[model samples]
Target: MKIRQKSREFIWGIYDFADTIFSMNVVSLYFPLLIVSDLGGKDIYVGLANSISQLLIVLTAPIFGIFSDRTGKRMPLFIISASLCAIGTLAIGFSAELGAILPVVIAFIFANYFYQLSLTFYNSLLPRVGPESRWGKISGLGTALGYVGSIVGMILVMPFNTGKIFGLNTFIPAGGRIATFTPTAILFAIFALPTLIYYLRDERRSKYPVDTVNRHPFKKIWETFSDTRRYPGIRRFIVSRFFFEEGVETAIVFMGVFAEKVMGMPDSAKIVFFVIATTAAVFGSIIWGKITDWLGPHQSLMLVLYGWIIGLIVLAIFPYRWLFYPIGCWIGIMLGGVWTTSRPYLLKIAPAENVGRYFGLYSLSGKAAAITGPLIWGTIILIFSGWNLFAAYRIAVATLAILIAIGTIILMPNKTLFEKHPIV
Candidate 1:
């Protein structure tokens, strides 16, 4: 029984490893370069594409969540959403090959929308993976593996873009940024199979029948919002998450572009930089997971937020190109820490029976921030376009820093939220 349980947990984490390959290749690395650098689009174009996808997720996630909860099943939704995301990713590569920027952006919007939506179901699977006591450890292990996936994904996709693997000659010729999309899509599908198969064979049907009576999606959304008042810490945590997540999500979308434009880093150097940063993130996720278990999720999350505030400030002010490397490492650590702590933090505070609904709200908060954060970034960049290019980006980074600071302040008082109802 213990071994079977462990296998389930391991398989669950593998999905994290799987999805991040898409995130690394498509979202964080090649896609942005394809849009702005290769296709002669602007940063705003990338921002808008990201924001639009996130907007879609924000609108749909809660309903999806409510539906999952009502049906008492997550695996089927997870598989369907992930498959659609993979298809959309493939479409992106095909559209990019045509050199029609609009089609590529449209494909990206759909791919990213499904990709982000899928996470709500994925995250809701946490309780099923382990006992509540082990949630932090399980979440951390998944996050660490996900960063490892980022490293591996970058290396695997490198040959497609540069025609060289690890800076060596290879049979695969350089195919440019478009080459990355197909392989990334394929990899996402292939790796997700283990969890999909496992669930298909072993998942038990939910005892709860689908709630057909509450058919109005908007009313369901209203009830869920009203339901949160009964859960003490959830509202405050979600509100705080909105601010910090905006800064974090914006940073992820723009970091590649920022490196290219502000620091004058080449694609090869950027790959190396990300590898180093991901390595730091791997360790950070593992360490912070232990901290979350030890210090409790709320306190652990507070520390992570503080780290973001400090890191974003340093990134904004530091002028030297060499300094960017270390800052990337710092950002990566905080990045992993945020997801690592935040997942378990929500699990700790939320009622188990309503996990799906609350996680949907959790997704809503993050997606809502994702929608606005990129737009805010794009607007700031446009406003400062006439100034020194480096100065424009610097000011933008500082703005994200302020947002994180605000989130940290909002989160501070919630320390008391956990004290009254301690996790066992």
Candidate 2:
């Protein structure tokens, strides 16, 4: 990572562009709401569908990474993962069966699986992408570009009122449902071309040849588990990430729900909420990346986590929730910084050769505990007044605060100092 290089950076940036389109299409802009409102499913059902996706990642991404490292060819896996996700989006767009939740659920589950796996290869290429001095900056900038794609995709899809595109009324498939997803699907396919070109360009520079192996995939998987504990930094960061991410998932799972049900936000304004938050996160990633270089990872994370805590507090405390526009702004900032910066720190600490395997470990640890945060909030309502909403929301915020505090203490002691300054 110490040597300067942008060939990989420029190439990988193209993939980020593609990935942003996919995340916007599936995660942020269109799909989840389509299932809930147009398809007549419960919000909990949406969570279950995505939870299944993450659960699959918990089970499979590590195996995928082990294979990726053993094989050293990333583009094939990247191509396969992105294609499956795009095809899954196409299927979701065409599905009209309300009672056939099984198909819809399965489509989303597989889409997310591919989406998450792509990252295993993407991250494994980081050392080739740029200098160690610039990893934080490049990673942050790439993430910012990705978020820009999300915002732009949302805006593009916002104007299409018809059931068709390219003179095809593909939005309405069956059962009186408007299953349109033309907006980002085209973007996903088109934007992905550049990434393919880039990865193919660089396949031979790094570990592109497959490794010699006689052991089973399961044996390789066990080897990864045995290897992870030997690195204390990776293990600690994974544990800290799990606890802090509980709060992240809690807020994300319920933000819009709280807006419409508790804060009495206008229904039309919810998408606007998404656009704003994501846009903010885009910039926050850039800003925090610079700061992470300057202040070091531990200090930067502390600041970002505090911002997250305040964002949660404002979400719960303000009587006229609309008055918290500033909070929303900060939430965008903190979201970008928290996620993008946190990652490069792990990349910095991990052993140089095993990035793929450790990243798989990263996905497994964070995602396997994905249910803990949401279930805690769900319990607040179940144990208190099932009919009451806002009070339980406050409890969720309180719980998140505790998580942030505990993580800060554990994180501070293990912070890595640069040889000279924290940044280049």
Best by TM-score: 1
Clashing pairs in 1: none
Badly placed stretches (over 4 Å) of model 1 are 205-215, 420-424
State model 1's lDDT: 0.87
> Model 2 off-target regions past 4 Å?
1-8, 97-100, 161-180, 205-215, 374-385, 416-424
Task: Encode model 2's per-residue lDDT on 1-424: one tens digit a residue.
Answer: 3232555566576677777777755664355555555565555666666667777888888888777767777678878888887887777655544446667767767776787777777767777777777778877877787777777765555445333332345544322223335556677778777877676667855554344664787787788677767776666777787777777755665666556555666434655666777888888888988987777666677778778877776666763566545666777788778666777778777776667777888777667656566556556645554655667656666777677666656665555543424322
Q: What is the lDDT of residue 80 in candidate 1?
A: 90
Whole-model lDDT per candidate = 0.87, 0.68
TM-score of each: 0.96, 0.85
Instruction: Report the Cα lDDT for residue 274, model 1.
Output: 94
- How far out, in Å, is residue 280 in model 1? 0.7
Instruction: Give model 2's TM-score versus the native structure.
Output: 0.85
